[model samples]
Target chain A: MKTYLKLAAPMALAAALAPVPAAAAWRLVDQGETRKVARSTLVVTAPEEWNRATERPSSRSEVWTQDGIALSELTFYAKIKDGETLFKRRQGKRNPLPEFDKDMLPTDLVEWYEDTANIVLGGSLFEIVEVTPATLAGYPGVHLRYSYTGGDNVARLGEARVAIIDEKLYLISFEAPRLHYFDRYIAGVRAMMDNARFK
Target chain B: MKRLLASAALIGLFAQPLLAQETGDETPEEKPLPSAHGYEPQDDLEKGLWYEMDEAEKSLKESRFLIEEPALNAYVRSVLCQTVGDERCAATRLYLLRTPQFNASMAPNGVVLVYSGLLLRMRDEAQLAAVLGHEFTHFEKQHSLRIFRQIRTKTDLLSWRSVVPVRLPYPAGMATQLAVLGSVYDFNRDMEREADAGSIEELVRAGYDPRAASAIWSQLGAEMDATAEERGHRSDKNRNGGLFATHPRSTDRMGRLAYLAREAAGDGAGELYRGAEEYRAAIGPWWAQLIEDQIALKDFGGTEYLLATLAGDDPLGWTGDLLYARGELYRARAEDGDFAQAADFYRQAIATGEFPAESWRGLGLSLMRAGQKPEGQAALRSYLELRPEAPDAALLASMAGEAAS
Candidate 1:
């Protein structure tokens, strides 16, 4: 614990304490060049390693950058037989499933979507019908009235909510039953983001 | 994170199912990837380009062609060669693509490539290097090729499992060729273990902080858990489908790596080993392009992990901005967005200097929407000063100025 604190304090402080040189506020959302991906058709071919009856999550496909992994690839975990187990097959990759490559993002996004979808790795979208000034954690911020549902074709589950401050490019989002968690967790995300900063 | 680097020796243990085949002579799982730093084996060090040799090339050719782009091909190869020890390693190559699950590959050659998903989850350089070092071992010692040759030679035995047909030149002795491949694989497995032990050394030698390796795997486990809940499944093998977890897994992998990292960090203030800044400079163009593109995919765990990793690095300046962006990501989704938290990320970004002019504007907008006038007005004014000629400058000034008056 001391090692972590000793090492982490410095790094985290460096991360937390480095004076951020103010740069031009870059808007990733609403950018004309930023591809607005309306929808992505996810396709997962359940590997033989996963049990079919359990509604096992098979594979997943999404957009990613061509080289850098940050913008590409979504990993899956080993299959754990939770119930009356058939194969007792520990947890792992199947001999049949191919190894995951870093470059899969470009293929999954562009090749799969035929280069048509506007692909950004993170951030949610909302229309600013009316913008109300607000502060949550002692910092200047805003609250946007629910404008539009995120995407028409491939919205994940519920009423999508995103947090934005002009200075940053990353956003935290949640999609659930829309009724309960959205209101509750949106604040939690806000709290987490409040604690977020780069030195 | 530890098992992520499969030791060549462990391959044999895991590969007991394969090595036990009838007529098997050599263990393909035993072979290691060729040397990255040009370390000559005490006796068998005949250097040049052993990984891209005949049998290995055939295996490479047999696999599906995943990357067809000219630029990406070069980029992938460059990372494979320049990542570890002494660099210039051209034997291993990585290959996973367009698939949903996460995975990485260390080819029979010295080249290795990690999936972008793996990259996304890695919280820091240590984790990335740990995974890379594990693969680097495969190339440093000629394991992948050695193993492939071993498996290729014994067609009579391997034919039961391998679907790819072994087609050698008519005059050549197929049996002899297969034996060579199998022998290499057998030895390569040991090479893999050597690499695992070496992952810490290489990381230390390379000067990357090591504990992140374990941290990365822990995060991976978290991602899987969340995903499992979403899909309503017992388990989801690998992030995309099944790629990274090919070896035995345990919570211990992280602990073991952490213990090793402690030993690696050593006593004195370490001299800068590998030039991360130089690396960042070189990849600037790609990084710039990717950051915008990443959030669009909307994978929660991956993006979250990536942002945290970026934040984990002290010298790196974009963590706050990335967080600010994440706030927007969620807010936009309002469906999945934690708006209140998004508001907090904006604040953090501003406090950390992570936010530039845009963050102020974002804060102001969010604030105004939430009915916090004074704070929103101040932030918007800051945004205008930072970006006086912004596309919406007129509107922003009007809104801010009106509030001030």
Candidate 2:
């Protein structure tokens, strides 16, 4: 368990800025149970119990948080087609977010994610620390480790696994504040990514 | 936390205003305050304000947003020292933040922040000194404390006005309320004007080209115009009412500064220093990173305008770095026909043989997107050879072919 009360004020301010739903929109996902996610053809078994956020970043993404989102959150993107973005476009935004391309190589995907992170984080503080060949659901993919400071000015570490199959993209990403939460939950996040499967 | 951050941002937005009441006559020169030696809080109110700034400054030192490059830090601090004397410069702490916005700020406790975007936008040392001098003047004049007191007093007055109603006609009542609100902004506007006039005197005294002060505003105004034209809307300066705005429009400031510069330069003045070459040399090593951050802003039109303007300054053709920047801009935008544009720019940059090795990679990707397969594959092979240990080398190698063809 993580400490939530210590940073309640800033966390509450962050929640206010986010597209949070009513209290009931948060659901519990029991450990060791497989479930479909994000209204897409992806399934995964939880390595631990989590509070699932229905107000996800995008239509094809689902968010699961162990503590508050200000601490740690895992997200899954499933079946993102070409020309679709990772998050919904903000109305009247002058600079459009980068869109997925079917012909994107593993490296292109990593660059695309970095661009998105820079836009979302609202600065140039995002840095990609490492990139390596990996597999998602036993298929070739790329894994990326990165870090960025959020709007709250807190440094967070993130890892993502991305793979494109049949002109659709699948991504699993986990992020948490770099202080203590990232190290604590990174292993479980990796385990969940290893076990993820296409339904 | 929220209020403190908001106030800091508000302070950062401080700039001179152009009031309509000004006759074209030159405003009187502003005398600089005495050297800040052993400055400290004189009262409890100031002490409280300093305490808040101290906390902010502590976090600022550790912020990931800071550009901690030693050379860059020293170069900027040297410029600040030139703007103010070394004595006053010692009393201020300068931080270069990697934010893609044209802004700078000085806090009550003498924490000065110059955003990276400001460095990228400035064409020469004179222009940079103009801004740095302005910010330092704010510190010397204690604008932050005065502004704080003004805001507190106004807030108290506003509260009393809300409860103790005075009868007035409909439009009269609304105008009266607006007048009260306008007074707060007007006070800030006056502070900005003083800082502006003060900086020009200092810029001239330091032997910099005073005209460079106004050139910064002209370039910024042009970029704002380009952005508006691209977005199909009225420019922000057009939409934001000058009365409600804390600072004057960029065009207004540009004209005002030009007038002040002319007056300060006087007749038969010797050629003053712009320091363009020195500025370029100081910023050369960080060019790629600075350009990357600017492009990441995704302000397509503004970036395009800025790149073209920079290219215009080159005596010959576009520099290899500028060409690469143009290619990156189009590639990142990825609109229809952008891939072809990107490929052309990348090709031009590669021909110079002074571009980053990544130019080959950019060329390959752009060509691939434009459906030029064999050439694209060849370019990709070249990139893999040049950067065999790149993080994406294996994937590019697999895409291009088994080996160099």
Candidate 3:
């Protein structure tokens, strides 16, 4: 019974706890370069070189990775309005993905995200480890840490920062397989989070 | 919502047993099929299938979804051995998967994949044995090989038609193709019926309750109906024996099996075995995980029905485990007034002497959500006391509003 909500270590400690493929469709974001994402409402300065995936997960989301998305990914979700979901809708899907609600508290939002991940990841084994109050893009929000085994059944770790401002949601999330990838890239993810801002 | 990833991709490597309808032929139990030996392919087609199946078995062995718990595997294998003779069990390799679906599939190469979700639905060893017996019959009767040959013949016919210069008009060609497809399904349905009859015979000979077969089928049918009702869809109970379904309708299968069970019990010999306590003991450690997996499917109606049935079946009264499972269910669903319902269930679970420590944690969360912060924090503190080394201890303490230790 590994219950939920372990308080995460400080970002500095997480930095202590913590790869690459070039593809035809992927573009490189050089170190120290600033990139606009999610229609320029959110921007991040690359702490290191990273590959940006050509196809976004959704219109409001941009994905970056050092390796393939399967092994590691950093996603940005911007200005998602109430009554909308993080992913595009699929017609005639038996169970529709839950929509975002403007009135959701940070805890409610985290629960919703866990439900979404369980549904989207093709029946993966998902668990939430921790959720804590935090500031995201200078707005009060929540930080979440979680783990899940996807289609490949590889144990993976994930972290996300989310905030609601003016009834619109903005989120930044990073995930990687728990072995060498998570520890190796966690510092970079933390630095990128520190560098994230409202454009 | 079991992933069914590897199993699905392997295609013909596995065969699922859906209970069968009475086909108006002689009951297969009246003349049991000869037992299958360790199969040796005697022809090119058989050889090809064996080779393909062997490769599929290799993939299944390395699949990440395989539940490698030795004790659990041994327990299930023991039940399978009890259902079929030990010699027959020797020919099969059982693999328990972590999937949350109600299914068990036997491959042509003697690989049996049992999904964990099926265990949740079963009340006792008899039901488990019933399902395994059905799958074993499929293997013993060489239904996969028969189906393969049938499919091959159909493919050959289509190929010959393609190469022929003479082409039938649109409707005739379409009808021909439909007939080919319909014949394959019909053959499959017949094989299912044979497997059902064979399983019932084995159960009787093994002295297990033959009625367990029909009981589980009925339960599954209700669960399916509950799922459909939850989704705001009309129950398709009146459909014509599910013309395109791989197995017959559950009602048809259940009714026929019940009839057979009564015939088998005409003399009603000494007490038949159910082994309910034995089944509960074997699954006790993993029950919570199974419940979690099922709830994650978000099938609230189905889960609620299942939990209610589980509670109703217990002669010893609702235990801590059942109470806590209900709490977890309501907590996860998080609908209107669910938090309060979840809190009450958690408290009831805690009142039970042998409750899970997570009950306190759930109580804390539910209470806080229900705006009872003081009581919620107290419950959180109690959980921390019980599970001092819990992975999320520090965070829980923080939520409990405790000073840094």
lDDT of each: 0.39, 0.70, 0.68
Candidate 1, residue A97: the lDDT equals 12
Reference-based lDDT, residue B323, model 3: 84
TM values, all candidates: 0.44, 0.83, 0.81
Candidate 3, B193-213: lDDT as tens digits: 787888888888888888888
Q: Considering the two chains of model 1, state its CAPRI-style docking category.
A: incorrect
Task: Give lDDT: candidate 1, residue B318.
Answer: 51
**Error in Å for residue B405 of model 1:** 16
**Candidate 1 residue-wise lDDT at B298:** 40
Of the candidates shown, which would achieve the greatest lDDT relative to the real structure? 2
Write one digit per residue (lDDT tens) for candidate 1, span B1-405: 232122222223223223433343333645432443443333232222243234434543343223334454454454333446334454344543221224454544333534444444444445566777766665554444344445546556434333321211110111222112322122222353466667777666666665545565666666556545543554443311232333333556556666776777776425434445544543444443344444544444445555665665554655665767766555433332254666777888777864545677767766665567688789889888888876456556756776688
> Runs in model 3 with CA error above 4 Å?
A1-25, A91-93, A101-110, A128-134, A139-142, A153-155, A163-168, B1-37, B155-187, B234-245, B313-317, B402-405
Q: What shift in Å separates residue B268 of candidate 2 from its native position after superposition?
A: 5.9
Residue-wise C-alpha lDDT for candidate 2, range A90-164, written one tens digit per residue = 434454678898887677788888877666555677788878778887778888888876646677888998899
- Kindly give the number of clashing pairs for every candidate: 163, 0, 1
> TM-score rank, highest first?
2, 3, 1
Model 1 chain B scores worst on lDDT over the 10 consecutive residues at B165-174
